[model samples]
Target: MAKTNSTAVAAALTNNQIKRTVDRLAALKAQIANLETEADNLVDLLKYQGKGVYFGNAHKFMVTTVTGKRLDSALAQSFLTPAQLLKCMKTTSTTSGRLYAL
Candidate 1:
């Protein structure tokens, strides 16, 4: 008879659980996107702005202003230059983990 180690079995089960959780999360995000589109359509139909409520749930509506700067490469090359732009830029590094099924 072959003996199986309990520790190995537990680790494999844990990995499988993690993979399943990731799959479930992806499905949930897709559902959320669909729901958000529906909500946006309803808000547009009602011409809602600033705040509102549905089924006794309190909701606050907001208009967000997003501002960004785009570099004029031609001007930058003639004047400040790419090297100068690099000097002002901030670089970030991050580490992330993903679970996969076998």
Candidate 2:
């Protein structure tokens, strides 16, 4: 039937689009991972010998010290009562979608 053929074509097109999107996402993930590694290396080199700042021809880098308290969730869970644990917890929801290659 014409309707069946049209539906098939639409499904094929949707699959192709999903594949392309997934491929693009994979490429972007690779690029981001590479950039993160490079950034981490740069940070380590710059932070060596207690250096705080570096001036370059195209970029400026500065090291900042931040102090904060973070909860040790595992330790807290072991020691705290259920009610106490609940008091320390905050719940959040995130919505996201991903396409994968088959």
Measured against the true structure, the TM-scores of the candidates, in listed sequence, are 0.47, 0.63
Expressed as tens digits, the lDDT of each residue in 37-81 for candidate 2 is: 998998888888474777899988887788899878899889999
Write model 1 residue lDDT over 1-102, tens digit each, in one string. Answer: 534755445454567786776798778777998999998897785555434433325765545446899988777778876788789779999988654444
Best by lDDT: 2
RMSD of each: 8.8, 8.2
lDDT of 1 at 32: 90
Local error of candidate 1 at residue 73 (angstroms): 5.4
Q: How accurate is candidate 1 locally (lDDT)?
A: 0.69
After superposing candidate 1 on the true structure, give the runs of residues whose Cα lies further than 4 Å from its correct spot: 1-13, 43-57, 60-74, 95-102
Off by over 4 Å in 2: 1-13, 74-80, 97-102
Q: What is the TM-score (0 to 1) of candidate 1?
A: 0.47
Clashes in model 1: which pairs? none
